[model samples]
Target: MRYACRPVGLLSRSDPISRFDVADVQRFYPRGRPPQPATFDWSFTMNLLGVLPYWQLGPWELGPLTLHSFGLSVAIGVALALSILGSRGQKILGVSGDRMQNFGMWLLIFGWCFSHVFEVVAYQPHIILEDPLVLFKVWGSISSVGGLIGGVIAFLIWRVRNPYEDHIGWSNVAAFTLPIAFFFGRIGCALVHDHPGADATNFVVWEWIRSIFGDSLPEVWPLALQYPDGVPRHDLGFYEAIIFFFLTLFVLYKGRKPQRRGYYLWTLPLLYAPFRFLFDFLRVTPGEAGLHGDTRYLMLTPAQWVAIGMFILGLFLWSKLRNEPLETWKGLEKSTSDDEEPESSSE
Candidate 1:
């Protein structure tokens, strides 16, 4: 979607464009009742079809409550995913409406919590152990791998109680819902300017986004690339948004077939790992706080190693599904005669 420049936090939180914009930045910060200041400087403007052009759109107020844009994007992702799964993707999700609703709720809760835990554990596990308050920090960031683990945990817990459902497996609904969340979550990341790329002035956000879909961008579109510091670098969030968006589209197409739903578990990792493993080379992150693979050996992120694991897991899972037939498992594919017999859908 289009981002309106409503500030999320203080200028100190995100690099201020210039000293002149400090007053303007303060005015837009999510907190405080500062006096009105002069108009914002040119450095903060984004020329998206002559738009309101601010980088954020705010802590929207609903009576006494306030909702941040990042939270809004994530909420939108979950809501849209549930809505789609409930109305359009029941077959793909392989659950009835009620169960889909339940699964979705658990997935969101566990997945969201785990997403945070994954990053915190990766970057700062000591903080979690030293201070228990870290668990309550809802505003903290999410990790993709952590979210994946959490959601799977949730699915398994749900499955243990409701074991009769054929679609209740490690790969089914989790695979279907994840990319959609990832695509939308990346939008949140881009809106917040959290995922920065390496020192590269050549790739503008919109231009690089265009290039992801096979459009050829110029050698250097001067003035086209701009960040909070007014120095252009790679926009990893935007890059991921495009890639995951296409992935969402692909999964949508693939989800129509019942058998294809099973493949998404392995397929998604295959698509994500290698490309992102290489992609990390262009993106910088704190290597020291992470695992050995990420910290040592010239700064490869933990995500890269996770990608390698995912690649291997995908291969194993693919081979298993290939060599094994579900027909051997009782009641996997029910016959027409069985439909006539009265039974719970889960059964």
Candidate 2:
């Protein structure tokens, strides 16, 4: 696309900038400015076969199978809740103890707010008229992008409050376990077919999918494919699962290494953002505009915009703290210093 600069005033006037076209800049831009990738026909296969176990859980039927999802949900809720409270209690014992407590607390508050805000933004009309309790019960509706934002916010809060606790190190270990939670959540999404993948279009993509699943794609019911009202579903879950699979393996490989204070948590958003941005293309959105690229140079879907903003913010904070080395011995040193102080007996 040929790029042009417009006067600042012209940009302010909607009509002038509205006429700008990104395609016009294509001819002038150097070939391969954006690298091309080898095309694959695995999308369909991924969609159909990747989600086989999920489909076995009937949507309308409430039975033992449903218990699996409820069980998974309870596991995550309990784990997170315990992490937050458990970590906080540990922090209370000393001036500066394990930073995990503060980190967990930040995650709870920020993650809750961001998730709710995105949910409210995505489905405002339903939320506005519906009781708040009802909204919580609606299982398939919370935004992953919002959860990502919450995690990023949590990282920033940790950095500001306790910059010295760097020894907990890169969040790779925490990140490794996170995908299992995601895997379970995805299983839930697939079981409910709660969030449908994108509509199949490419024959290669479809054919590759059909070979593995054997006609299951055409037979899957609409209830499995449909999204909640006011939102469009995407076929990106399979892709997400694939990425997380590799990520989990990477984390396992590095599991023996100790992470710095903030590294384990912050890595989640950094690794997750690009996929979220790219996956936005496969799904339908209300009114997404691409004045430059879909990465929101101009207009973007709510989720996309949130992803971009969070990605930038997360990157900035990561960069700021990237150099700080975690000091494992500091806690012991501080304790020793405390013990050396003169003791006074109270009358």
**TM-score, every prediction:** 0.66, 0.51
Please estimate how well model 2 matches the true structure, expressed as its whole-model Cα lDDT.
Answer: 0.49
* Prediction-by-prediction clash tally: 5, 26
Candidate 2 residues 161-263, lDDT tens each? Answer: 7677532342322344565556545545554443344443342444675667566454332222333432333435545666666665665565444344455
In candidate 2, where is summed lDDT lowest over 10 consecutive residues?
288-297
TM-score for model 2?
Answer: 0.51
How many angstroms is residue 84 displaced in model 1 relative to the true structure, after the best TM-score fit?
2.5
**lDDT tens per residue, model 1, 10-49:** 1222334555555554666545554332334433332222
